[model samples]
Target: MAGPSYLVNILDSNHVSAPKGSVPSTTLALTYLDLPWFPSAPMQSLFFYEFPHPISHFMQTTLPTLTQSLSLTLQHFFPLAAKLICPPPPLKPFILYSDGDSVPLIVAEFTGADVDHLTANYPRDFKLLHPFVPELPPSTMSSDGILVMPIMAVKVTVFPNTGVCIGMAHNHVAADGSAFMHFMRSWSSVCKSKGDSTFLDEESRRPFYNRDAFGDPDGCNEEALKCYWHWISSWRENLAGPTKEISSVDKVRATFVLTRAQITKLKQWLTTQCKNSSNDSEEVKISTFVVTCSIMWICMIKSQENDIQVSTNGDDDDDDDTFYYLLFAVDCRNRIGFSLPVTYFGNCLAPGIIRAKKSELMGAKGIVTAGKAIAKKVKEMESGALKEAEKGPSNLEEMFRSGHHVAISGSPKFRVYDMDFGWGRPLKIEFIHIDDGGSLSLIESKNESGGMEVSLVLSKNQMDAFTSNLAESLKAF
Candidate 1:
């Protein structure tokens, strides 16, 4: 049966406001977290919110309010209105803000689909969400061949009586998930307060953009940049362009809700397993993030057993030579001591990797091993991991190109459900192009209660097996 689909009409497209008149152009140097995304892959997200009012009321009343509120909100976030400027060598990349600059705000409407089906937990055609996402401006190269791209673009689509979805595509170098959420929360706050700027909190009103604030005591930014350029140069052949579009993938996307009780059970089971293990020195500090991520990682790997068997050409199925890695990213705002504001906007994340052999992952201690690896990485972050990244050698290219990688995007800590743009909280929030490239989005469930919505894209067969394994494993817990 054909899944739901829709056509998007680009009703309006224009830029939002930025700092004008006598305000000197603001330039923010790229930090370590920002450098990796230099060539820029715009991360897109769709937030589905239920609107009780009729379509006319929304188009007439609500749309104007949202538009105005977003404009007012953007006034404070001028960088979103700006473009990334990378001059010729000897000049580092920075955000350039000038008068009349604005973010591209697109209003689109989608039709010919069932809204209920679109919002459901069951697997659906990932292509259905593509039209809602506005395309980012293509990257431009200077006469000297330095590349720069648009920082952000936004689209808001309506589904008649069903609901509305706000689609956003932003440069990762410009803002990490935390910074992005801060902007979004601020926009919603403005909308909820009837465009009252006064009601906004300090975090929203004042996002520290000082790139110098992060005391790169060990010159992590330079080291990271060097490592990044090296990786890019090596992968230049594969970097030509995206090989496949969203429609080319025969994949399904599903959002599985894991309640707090289920996650707690999983963690407890891991803790008990660790205690019974031979390694008494290991501390069982399995957190909700670690436990949930570990479970998903396990399920994903287990579900691919058939593929592994086929690829190995009848080699030992239990081969310890095969590689498996769980690539996760962490926000370093709090870990940097007192240098940067917790609300400091812009990229503040560094990647963390935990790898194991395929045999180890398929073993009984799989969950415990994965959990411990994550715990160790977390501890490392607490003890100057960011600073150490400068001196340590980088595997950025290898890790990215490795077929064994399963990365985590977004976070459960963001409380995305709390965002209310005057209508109500979102019914569902999912990454649009997650299927194009494989990555797991871990976000707080919309229920307000403690839980996680694990959203990912996998081929049809793998998705079915993954879902089945996920259910069975959680049931066992």
Candidate 2:
């Protein structure tokens, strides 16, 4: 197998900021919800769009529009251009923005690259897509030795007459997926309007910056911070390690789709299974999301069964009793008992976790078992989004060591395909960060056919097994 042969030529690199005086100097405190994700990796995404025009045309026209609109968009989303100020120990972390703060944007061109293959649904070399995204600038030390990290960076890579990819890297602590998608749509709207934002409603154009909107009566903020410090004490190397080098492992990324009809079939099958089961009293709230995730969970576990057994040295008793977990985030903007604006920014996500024994999840009733567990966890969230907020960090660490776990990123409701920057909807959107193990990204289908797209990265052998398992499961449905 040949290594990635494409070369990326850096065309320009510069910083962009909001218009002078448009955004006042600000300091935003990190909420308890944000602190846990402070040490995690930055969220990286690549949005590909077809651009069947010459490079000269792109430079002469598209480049200026993108850069200018981004600057204008920052006037409204100024926090994205802010720097995260991490003071040592007892001092809490906060985002700071003053005069002259700006986001780093890089322009590049990929030579000898196939846009079609990169945008295809089939497996492709994971490393080949890395260069399209810009790396966040290295964290700097303040005069007092505090860590100062940029929150976001942007890169635009042109495939020269084939397509263009707008890549972004943003600190997850700065914003959750909901907030990030809001910024994306806002930026695209501005670019599409050729730098006019008046077309958007005031509520849509600006984010509510009041951190006080999120009430934390339980002192979860302080507790969450304690958890962060405790976790970081053991990972001192990762305190400023979001810029860690990309993995060198041989991996391939592939996209799979579950159409509306297929998802319905899975739901029907689950209903029938529940009706026939001895434990029919158990309530499983079946939905498109539940069924899709349930089927994926069953297939993923079956696909990796051999590897799990080998890692456990074929300890049948222990292996059967071992637990596998799935974690996903739920947007809490509306769920929390507060009148927070839907546009209120920062992280308002509650962790949704499901744990199932290996034997249960791999059984013939795996989908039913997984669905019941997931639906229960989600139902628990309805009582209070942050019901057990303080234990999140410790719980997350335990799941990581459990050896069999998966984290779901993005969401079908994001409507990522609706983001049109005058060039049209994105041909494909890839969540670059999911290449890290035990993660998958989901988004709405590009064709507006009410289907959902799931993307993940795996080794060749694992991908083959996953494909086979998915086919078999769907056939059963």
Candidate 3:
């Protein structure tokens, strides 16, 4: 499958536009939302272990298996993801979230390369992957006015031992993390089961994220839904305050395991700290995992210097002491209005945010406050769920008036554990950068040996601080 392969291509001029819909006309801003909002756009982190160690058999090829077709089996379960878009989702609708006139989907492209091709041929070290022509043709697009593609067509390259990585980027309006993972697995499952025809039948199109389980289109008022739109608009601009795009070395990834005793002590400490505190009626229970993250970031910053630094890589930039710490993700199965069970279809549900500054999060009390703050914000998301989004924000527009400054974004949506293509869980789950930004994920589960562990994937510099600070922070209580 080399030069001009048998793939569909949907060029912008040849494609149709999103069909007219009833959704609202107002642009939405994540910061403007009345309640705390998650991704201004729907995004996710997917983890996969290097093909489980059967050591005897493993190889990486662009197209792993010689199926009848070169296009991914993704066409099987998530054709929407890998196909091209004709009529793109309108740009204004996403203004609240993306902050730009262009759709993130069309702005990005997917090009595949063998890991060896990258290590040996590329002029640059294996740091980034760029866009290229798409294969899907014009037929895949819909007439809708929105340029929403269930799946973004991507070229997949194999990593001899690491398995295949299929690049996917879509309109943030369409899918979130959980939705993306379900889509990713469903897409790959079809590929692995090439011999089997029953994997993703028409029945699989059940609308997992909507009230209906089938391919039924939802009937909520599109304009009324902007209530959801305007709310997030305010959250981004108003309550969250302005975003600052500080520059720093890329944060890296790391993993650490803790004893049940260590986990318990940390949890106890946080609970006790919240005891006398008067915040919300909701119990101050904390996920041991969230505590680990706060500790991770604090240690991350401390190891670097007495205070965190924030520079936007600008030659004329001022003040270098601004930094923010992010907490992991939470499942929105219940958070969103969709009451359907967490199903195995296109992505469903959404997430909320948990952020703190470097100075405030330096010491023990600081970590506790940061973690607790995350819990509180998520809890707000729990109680209000969709309603909060309808309320909108008073101070929202000011935040993203300019397109810069988003600090550490964290997510703990680990779906690698739930997916099983018959080969049991893989040995290691790692995330490759598909998006430009600082991202951190926290997982709470047993490792390959059934022991507790905390794994972090972040920018390179953050990794150094995290390791040194973690060693000391872990010793503290």
Top lDDT prediction, candidate number:
2
Measured against the true structure, the TM-scores of the candidates, in listed sequence, are 0.91, 0.95, 0.57
1-477 in candidate 2: lDDT tens per residue?
355587888888999999888878999988888888866788999999989998899889998999899999898899899998877677888999997799998988888868888898998887778888788888876677477789999999998878899999999989999999999999999999999977444765578878876667578877877866664455545445554455666678999998888887888888777667736466767777788788887777776775556666876455678899999888877665655677878988877878999889988788888988887788777766667454576687788899789888999888899999999999999999998757888888887576889999887767878899999888987
lDDT of each: 0.75, 0.83, 0.40
State the lDDT of candidate 3 residue by residue for 312-374, as single tens digits. Answer: 343433223344534233454544554545553333333344445545665447767776776
What ranges in model 2 sit over 4 Å off?
199-201, 230-240, 243-245, 278-282, 308-318
Best by TM-score: 2
**Could you arrange the candidates by TM-score from highest to lowest?**
2, 1, 3
* Stronger candidate by lDDT (2 vs 3): 2
Off by over 4 Å in 3: 1-150, 159-171, 188-261, 276-282, 300-330, 335-337, 344-351, 354-359, 391-413, 418-424, 433-437, 444-462
Q: 154-224, model 1: which lDDT tens digit per residue?
A: 88888777788898988777888899888898888989988886644455456777777666656776765
